[model samples]
Target chain A: MIRHVAVFRFVPEFTTEHREHWMALVRALPDRIPQLRSMTVGADVLRGPASYELAIVADFDDLDGLEAYTRHPAHAEVLRISAPVKASLATVDFEIPDAS
Target chain B: MIRHVAVFRFVPEFTTEHREHWMALVRALPDRIPQLRSMTVGADVLRGPASYELAIVADFDDLDGLEAYTRHPAHAEVLRISAPVKASLATVDFEIPDAS
Candidate 1:
């Protein structure tokens, strides 16, 4: 499997409602994107100095599956809403070796 | 549960061996820190424009458990080794609500 992890810090103007709407769209992705094996999205609870505002962790069978989800219209819709409000975004895509 | 996600960007000077050593230590953390419910670590595969070098995703039952894992000597040791070579790091700690 491949894991796609994204952490986001919203712009100063981003409001609570914006966050809620964005998270809702992200949480609904697994149902909308067929390539998603599993998905989880969450709002930061700690709000620490190093903390980002939100996170999305999703799993795919392979890079092709991940690419399919990334190009999916549902994901594009979510990004369209989030892109304007995002201040910083960092992502990591990595392989998850099967357990022996 | 609380999910703690950390993504790292290593310094330009950091070499492949340094990354391997760091990952080895991070992968061994669950055995040294009992507060962890589960943990996963991986080096980035995509090397995309927005990609960070590595990611660590760990779960704990609650904030207390998360704190315990964070402050544990073993975790501190890992940080001692990683901090010097790290160029940037971002973290998010968020609640994982139980399924209804």
Candidate 2:
């Protein structure tokens, strides 16, 4: 399986409305995007300087499944909503080997 | 629970030996760190420009548990081994709320 991990640093002005919107969209994605095997997303509870505002981890069967999830219209919609208020973003996509 | 997610961009010269070493160390952590709830780690299978070589997600009971794991000597040892070969590192530690 391939897991895509993304961390988002939203603008300082990001509010609860943005949080609710983003979470709703992400939570609804598994149903919209068939290739999305599973997903877990949450916000930072700590006020540490190194903490990012949001983190998302999603699993797919393989690279192709990940590509499909990225290209899906539902995902594009989420990006459109997020782009304006997003300050920084970092992502890492890796394969889970059978053995540890 | 708090999830500590870290993505490592290894230096260009990072070798297979380094990969083996890191994997073995990470895989052994659960036995040594009592605060660790779970962990999943892997390397990038795709050579995309955006890819980070290694990704790790470790869950703990709470922020204190995470702090304990971070201060654990075994984890510090792993960090010492990885520092030289790591190029860039990005991490996001977030709380998983009770609701979706």
Candidate 3:
């Protein structure tokens, strides 16, 4: 499996309602994007100095599955909402070895 | 459960050996730190414009367990190895709702 992890810091002007709407869209992605094997989306509970505002961890069978999800219209919709309000974003894509 | 996710960008000077040694230590953390329920560490497969070089996703029973893992000597040891070589680090701690 491949894991895709993204952390986001929202712009200071992004309101509670905006966050709720964005998070809802992200949480609904697996249902809309068939390539997602599993996904978890959450708001950061600890607003520490190094903390980002939100995170999503999603799993795919392979890079092709991940690419499919990335190009899916549902994901683009979420990204459209995110792009304007995001202060910064960082992502990591990595392979997950099967259990020994 | 609480999920702690961290993304790191290593300094330009950090070499392959440094990464392997650091990864070995981090992969050994779950065994050394009993507070960790589960952990996954990986080097980034896609070095995209917004990519971070490494990422870790770990789960704990609660904030207390997370705190214990953060304060553990073994974790400190890993930090010592990571601190100087890490150009940037970002973290998010959030609640993972139980599956319905």
> For each candidate, what TM-score against the reference?
0.95, 0.87, 0.96
Candidate 2: deviation at residue B69, Å?
0.7
User: In terms of lDDT, which candidate is stronger, 1 or 3?
Assistant: 3
For model 2, which pairs clash?
none
lDDT of 1 at A78: 92
lDDT of 1 at B58: 92
Which candidate do you rate higher for lDDT, 2 or 3? 3
Model 2: runs farther than 4 Å from truth?
A47-49, A98-100, B98-100
Best by lDDT: 3
Please state the Cα-based DockQ of model 1 relative to the true two-chain complex: 0.86
The C-alpha stretches of model 3 lying farther than 4 A from their native spots are none
Residue A99 in candidate 3 has what lDDT? Answer: 80
lDDT of 1 at A5: 95
Error of 3 at A33 (Å): 1.3
In model 1, residue pairs whose N, Cα or C atoms come closer than 3 Å (at least 3 residues apart or on different chains), thus clashing, are: none
Model 1 accuracy (lDDT, Cα)? 0.89
Candidate 1 lDDT tens digits, B3-70? 89999998878888888888888888888888998888899999988899999999898999999998
Model 3, span B1-100: residue lDDT tens: 9999999998978887888788889888889999998898888998999999999999999999999998999999999988988888888898888671
lDDT of 1 by residue, A1-100 (tens): 8999999998878898888888888888889888998888888999888899899999999999999998999999998988898889999998877670
Clashing pairs in 3: none
